[model samples]
Target: MAKKKVSKTIDDINRKIKEGKVVVVTADEMVGIVKKNGAEKAAQEVDVVTTGTFSPMCSSGAFINFGHTKPGIKASRTWLNDVPAYAGLAAVDCYMGATEPREDDPLNGVHPGQFKYGGGHVLHDLIAGKKVELRATSYGTDCYPETQVKKKITLSDLPYAMMLNPRNAYQNYNCAINLTKKTIYTYMGILKPNGGNANYATAGELSPLFNDPYYRTIGLGTRIFLGGAKGHVIAPGTQHNPNAERHENGIPLTPSGTLMVSGDMKEMDPRWVVGVSMLGYGCSLAVGLGIPIPILDAEMAEYTGVSD
Candidate 1:
């Protein structure tokens, strides 16, 4: 059998955007609206659905290229705010992963891996317009002869600052609750022992993938709001499971379709991109993303109506 498709096209959605007629609603708000008005009516009335999520995403980072200094050197080593940045790409180019730790951090000491300062913190500081010390050691080349360089720089000073998150935006995630007697520290926030309190990430009804459920509108190159900046879905994220059990409404019962998103780091706001420190565990970055779904047809409308 041939597959049924959404009648909406990218051009149709663009026209709505141009006219500012694109109807947008949080995932949570759509639930109430869908309940009050049937999916058929709601589909006709609504034009777009916007969803957002803020959670500790470990697979987040940035690739920065600091403009070469006078008497340029091939940077063999680089450090951002005392945290080692991978500078093996090219001279003055480096990638800072979210979980990279501070070398001087008291890992086994008093605070035991409590990252007071790290790559995430540095990125946060950069976004916050704070000056971060940049240090590099290089093997001097005749064409680009310089050995050592030390400078203080901000995000504004860099020629290229791009947020390159490898894996993010899980379609559906799980709520964590510790069954052990002892308290557990996890990426899903601190899990209380004996189910004292359950912690669930994602915006629930306000999550992007939760609203779409299926990969109809949201697919490769779909424009999205990432880190408070415009970004696009590049590919399926790591462990992108599409064949999960689904409810009658098409919403997945398990975690499904993830997204690999990227955007300009400079355009990101500090509010949406933040450094996070898990109490007992290592550090992570809290990333916020929002996607606008156009109501092209009844199917799109029905998809948006699926609630928490």
Candidate 2:
């Protein structure tokens, strides 16, 4: 008796098949095929990696029917766990209320009695120049400590201005803040302060705080991402207030603060799904691998179609 060796070539295996030519493989075998296909090749290929760092800590909301003329809409933070951070948010379909229809309707039987559409134009209008309060805790401080230090520190008067730099994947836009009035206005323009001029004396000039190298030393707006129970506190409700609790240890202090920061967040807009998809697919092919593609802008635009 002699030992037999199996050949690995596709042609050698095909010759052994029966007349019907049916070949079944195991689960592990199929998995190996998938892994092999997914592996990156060294051949010269265009790599389309998403640029810039991504953050998932920020909160987002939406408004609809902004003006009275248009319908009102609502905005909320988008939850995209399965989608990559660089891929951005997803868009959803919206609709408006129904009205009485005319007797003579075209495509009579084919169409429904009434049509549906999205809402929230009024909500958008109401959000303009509106103040949003965000509360975050500094590390090494217990939120419910007793005998806490209480101070009414004016952030704007701290000899520097604070600016929020959102990811560039979304459209770059300008926002105006009236700290005295606690109002913020968003618009499309250069993000530079002082009305985008060379000099910095104007009301809208970039805050000098950001330029100072020593700003981080005094713990000015520095934040650490805390995971699970001990992390920063993000109270869901609209009210932004900080309260102290009595405990066995010495007085624990927690500070309550508000940010007058504003910027154009259209970069996180769901309408850009189509563009993301096209880029993802193109990049995947260029790299000779099946990369996970994000939803495209066209797809979202289709979902959030014009309101009638």
Candidate 3:
């Protein structure tokens, strides 16, 4: 006997969503469906699987265009609350990284393990609607005459503010533990002496890419929940290694793929995007994100059905 094939398109799923007939379930729920009804039968009943995660994502940042200043100074250097922002683009346009440390920051000076402020905090302040001191300088040019500008700015002050992260949502990562006799501080969080504790970054069963292990349903233009706002996948994330060795079940054993996600920073919720300075690992943003996988076939259903 031949096996039955199941398939559906995104448009078909959208039409179902509009008609209030789409069968949506969390990735965790799909596990039971595949185990009981089998992937083929589960695919016939389920339409989409949703995945979510929240963790420290260092490669996150924002790009802001602060509308041309009077006298139009082409900003060659920029800083926000002592944190440097890359002003390599046009006048008044800059990019601030979440992990970039600030000048006079104790972490860079007297302090070695504890940090207080960074670009991530600056971003958080803006999202919280707090006005931050903005300082800019430029070598007066023929086209852009002003040499400098200083002022307080908020999210609403900028012409455009985009949360353009270069790399995020790592597919899978390491579980760290200290084998030595001494305590150590790491990005995965503080590890106790002699393997007394362990830390891992992934959300296990609720992670996004782990569900669509083969990238069948997620690609460029796929809509997602980013920092509490609706965002889209613009391109393959940085360090996206599709050929990484995988288990027989398709789960990668190492830190493999990553995503370069973007969305409007203005629309993001402050709660969903948090700034943090680790004990020894410096600074980064705790980003919240989610992706919905369309179970177009039995194969996709089987993949999403895998649990932690």
Candidate 4:
């Protein structure tokens, strides 16, 4: 069989952004958005904030910061106004082969893959304070591959790859996973756990829990853990379990013991929710959110940035 192409184009990048699939943005770009216009003005310009993607097992999201000054209530309101009522379903990361291969040998060159591609926008106008939270509901389908083994594996255990949509590469976010039910969770918040100047010798640093398979499943009233902290866990009552039977046709369903991994949203900066309302009012209506997005690179880059 012939090898599949691994590179993407500018158009592909734009398409993902318009769809609200891209959400991470750079600190400079985010700061520019805020500086160009107050938070509300920047918020209105956004389309879809791309959270990170998970293939069969992994994920990431865009990040942001507010500096020392807090965004005003009006700016915060504008930020809220730009967001969709219900953020789409959470997307699961899957492994895509660098090249197309026979069905019998699909995993040949596959690596950690991201759910979608595109850029993201950040809201710097919001207040910067401890325990401040940004709330937004996510909507996307989960693709679970049937398991061949009986033992459970953390998403970090699987071999995976990434595909980048160059336009929106600066986005960042903290990530979590629900193993039992096989779901990925993302949140917009401060980046202390994922960021900071803690060295290996330090003891009091916040340690993030990534790829821990013992976490709970996704269900109504299920406690969703974010970045390894109990305080970050989303209470069971906040989100509901997805119906297993009504999954999209193309998504593969893995059996029990499947390894489900999630990426941690970085804390160095503030994250953005690319608002898709500028182009249209309907959720189904697609709009390009022009921001560079990142994917899990085969070879890790010094920092996630746009490809020239």
For this target, which candidate reaches the highest TM-score against the unseen true structure? 3
TM-score of 3: 0.95
User: Which residue runs does candidate 3 get wrong by more than 4 Å?
Assistant: 1-3
Looking at model 1, the pairs that clash are none
Give all candidates' CA lDDT scores: 0.83, 0.19, 0.89, 0.23
lDDT of 2 at 270: 21
Residues 156-228, candidate 3, lDDT per residue (tens digit)?
A: 9999999978888888899999999988888888899999999988888889989987788788888899998
Q: How high is the lDDT of residue 4 in model 1? A: 50
Candidate 4 local Cα displacement, residue 86, angstroms: 17
Cα lDDT tens digits, model 4, 1-308, are 97342343436546866886754444234444445554444433432222222111112222222111121111121112122111122222222111112123222133222212112221111111123223222221133222111222222232321221111111111243233422222222112343332222100101111111112222122222222211122222211222222213211122111212122323212222221111111111111112122222211111111111
Q: Which candidate comes out best when scored by lDDT? A: 3
**Superior candidate under TM-score, 2 versus 4:** 4
lDDT of 2 by residue, 159-198 (tens): 2211122111111112343334222222211133434432
lDDT of 2 at 293: 13
Q: Counting only residues 3 or more apart in sequence or on different chains, how many pairs clash (N, Cα, C under 3 Å) in candidate 4?
A: 81
lDDT of 4: 0.23
